[model samples]
Target: MANPGGGTVCNGKLHNHKKQSNGLQSRNCTKNGIVKEAQQNGKTHFYDKLIVESFEEAPLHVMVFTYMGYGIGTLFGYLRDFLRNWGIEKCNAAVERKEQRDFVPLYQDFENFYTRNLYMRIRDNWNRPICSAPGPLFDVMERVSDDYNWTFRFTGRVIKDVINMGSYNFLGLAAKYDESMRTIKDVLEVYGTGVSSTRHEMGTLDKHKELEDLVAKFLNVEAAMVFGMGFATNSMNIPALVGKGCLILSDELNHTSLVLGARLSGATIRIFKHNNTQSLEKLLRDAVIYGQPRTRRAWKKILILVEGVYSMEGSIVHLPQIIALKKKYKAYLYMDEAHSIGAVGPTGRGVTEFFGLDPHEVDVLMGTFTKSFGAAGGYIAGRKVREGPLVSV
Candidate 1:
């Protein structure tokens, strides 16, 4: 739901201020004569204020509101078999290479349709077709080059005339373009093209630290972590953060990698209707109402996950609003800006820069370097630190 506040910090617990005559639970934060209400659904409430302080120490207290501890340990996968089965069926339904066919049977009788009936309808034999040659089209780029020509030597080869476009270079860091080519070449000449062993064995190089430092400085975060591709960063971190009794809140359209990671974490998965903040709040409120009857392990830590820019829609996430919800509900927030950096924001600083949020404002920031930076690989920027190199040998 839209934030009703005119832009100010709103604080309060989730409360239905109309008086709990229905035996349903609710809490409204009231301070200085201002009140924030929790709708009857009891999902989430909009605080009139931004959270200047995070209640990291009071996770259990927040769980108290979720009295069966409804969502304490909910994970993402296989929780609802109907959904999982449906997804599996859909995935399996894809036409396999062997069974799929694109050829259409040729119809001899249809030959009359193309040449006789259709061609005759538009035939004009005597009329002269207009063909006037136009002079070479040119652009007026003032003071750009010494030759003042619109293009380089006209390159028109039958096999190689057009610009090469099929390079899998995402970060624009291809050897054909980036200066890193020469730097890497020199390094390879001195250190050899390949490291003989894993990082622990002997693959370690000073260049690794140099690249890591650059990433750390660019992100301006406390620590930066890198990992092997295809293995996925979510799998590496999610399981470690939540353990057995944790809940992962996934948007309806979250990428499959995250869905899989959350499942593998062995945590309970509770899906909030996609981008429905109100629904998320209701689920959390339900958790609070349910958790009140339990203690400790009965409750689950909550984490909200979303993408900074959805690939299908090219729509950007509203980070400020999401941050607000996280504060009121006391949930951790994780955002994947894989498609956002170097493309959306004015200065191309990714979602945070687009929204003007502080780096520490988000719990974790993840993005790939393929698009805007025009290179390969991805990066994870967060406050958490781990000893030794993050990549596996």
Candidate 2:
């Protein structure tokens, strides 16, 4: 290429015009420190690059792609700046729209879920809400939005749900068909779901005694007695059996029912390490030595209380070691088989059966049927050293 005045000649042509990706040209400008713009007043001029001088300098596709990329970059940059000023750059309408598409509408599909649920909540006293309020705020609702979380219209759903953790049905009795239910139904028909009175105060019905008989048969014991609940069985019997002056050696791992009952007995309570024969013997030996010298009062009726199975750890007690220790120290023993009754031992006689020990080895065997049998009461099975124990079960 040559300049017009024959000043020089070169293969490359000098471009007279330069264009930006936007197809806008830069105003007449400088290239190599040559002045491109003149100042006017106090303002400086900035000009955009526009159309290029030569189209043959680059391939058509390459040129078009570069221009398109530049145009798109400018467009997005403007949009971003615009949105940032409006404080909406971070919000995505597309994302919110996608989320809205995935919801289960509360009103459209789940009706009657309203009244039954609200009534049930009030009936159950779930939150312990106030009972004295005027009714039907729903009569004035144009739409639903509350001054608080929920409007006065409906006692809005406050709590999500209740999970059943304390049902305590260990044997899954509720799920069984045929035999257990049939037995329960037959028994219920004969003796009502519950007795109308207490045992000492006319609460004890014939069915109550019958159940006790059934329990004794189950535990293979001479006698058994039932209480309204598993907790009551121990609560009442413990104080009656052990007087205020007696010494009771209890295991540290014994249940709260045993703890409360023993406390109520007003007995001298001594606790040994859980299931440790050595620990129990130490206490028993002390009682025997101290009880005799201090008073000639039958040398203290020493009662040893323990659980047949530890519920938390699912550990079984060594009945042989305990029974042997009881005999060695002339102590009467009580065993609570709450978690063991129907699970341990060969014939389901609990720890006694598990150890090949006779039922007579335990002075009193107490436990609940709400666990293994899937039924709802607790019983104490025992044999008398002097008189034969009678069972109403």
Highest-TM-score candidate: 2
lDDT of each: 0.56, 0.63
RMSD of 2: 39.1
Top model number, lDDT: 2
User: What TM-score does each of the candidates earn?
Assistant: 0.54, 0.55
> Candidate 1 — which residues are off by over 4 angstroms?
1-175, 191-204, 292-300, 384-393
lDDT (tens digit, per residue) of candidate 2 on 1-393 = 222211121111122322344443344545323223323333223222221223236888998998897676556555754685499864221122456757764354224333322332233322233222112111221222243212235445443233334444555655447786797789779877776766779787777778778878887777788776898788778888887678889989888899888999888898998667667777876787667445645544788888888776566665655665666566788889989988776667687666555687678899997887776778888863433222222
Each prediction's number of clashing residue pairs: 47, 18
Q: RMSD in Å for candidate 1, one decimal?
A: 19.0
lDDT of 2 at 219: 77
Can you give the lDDT of residue 13 in candidate 1? 23
Local accuracy of candidate 1 as per-residue lDDT tens digits, 1-393: 223322232222222224455676556656433355555664444433222332245577676866434342222222433453467523211232544344553444334333332333233321112222111221221222122222223323222122333323334444343466677678879988667686567766887667666766676667666544422766666676665666777877877767787888887788877556566777776665565235534355777888888765555665666676676566777787777766666566677666555665667777766556554566677665533222121
